[model samples]
Target: MKVKKQKRHRKSLTFYTACFGFRKPYKVLCDGTFVHHLVVNRITPADTALANILSATVKLYTTRCVLVELKRLGKSYSEAL
Candidate 1:
């Protein structure tokens, strides 16, 4: 006797949309380079792009290491950050 195989059904787009009704929050780690680019020259295209990308659904965070490095780079810039 031959056994019959059953086909699996995939979830629909509406099912996924209903499952995720709200945008998920994201945590982003900020390093020395990101901070430097942000504070340097007041603003740049890269900074603007970063801002646009992180404006929604993201929270920025940094560690003591990054702060210490920024401090060592320059007092004014570090303070701005």
Candidate 2:
């Protein structure tokens, strides 16, 4: 099942790279919720995890708004920031 999922993800990545010129060291945009999930689930070393999922090198990015949101959410979410 995991192999199948990986293959499917690879296929989708291929499509994006081919048609949209997405390249490796793929850039991943993360939101507050995503960061929270990572913290809550103890998904440490987020870049490595995302890279494995995308089957390529990855760079994670978050916007100022996301940072603010996480900050506003307070201490429980502070680790995510």
Candidate 3:
């Protein structure tokens, strides 16, 4: 039997839309150098609810799952960076 050698790349690329994203409620970022949970708290019928969804988008973070390492923020969620 013969064994094959594994290959590795020096760099890789990914898009934020590929991971977590939304057209409304929120946009989840999964960047290695810069990542954050972006959301807009919109008031619903009687209370606030996440209008847009981004569950699968967050899946982009494999070994470095950003969701698991998320920290509750105190700044304005609507702030544009």
lDDT (C-alpha, whole model) for all candidates: 0.57, 0.84, 0.28
Clashes of 3: 4
Which ten contiguous residues of candidate 2 have the minimum total lDDT? Answer: 72-81
Question: Better model by TM-score, 1 or 2?
Answer: 2
Candidate 2 CA-lDDT value? 0.84
lDDT of 1 by residue, 18-51 (tens): 7856333445577888778767656544434444
Q: Over the stretch 1-81, how does candidate 2's per-residue lDDT look in tens digits?
A: 399999999899999989999998898899988888988898877898887898789888888888888888886665653
Pairs that collide in candidate 3 are: 19-57, 20-57, 20-58, 25-52
Ranking by lDDT: 2, 1, 3
TM-score of 1: 0.49
Off by over 4 Å in 1: 1-23, 44-51
Clash tally, candidates in order: 0, 0, 4
Task: Indicate which candidate wins on lDDT.
Answer: 2
For model 2 the local lDDT of residue 81 reads 39
Kindly provide the TM-score of model 3 when superposed on the true structure, using C-alpha atoms: 0.17
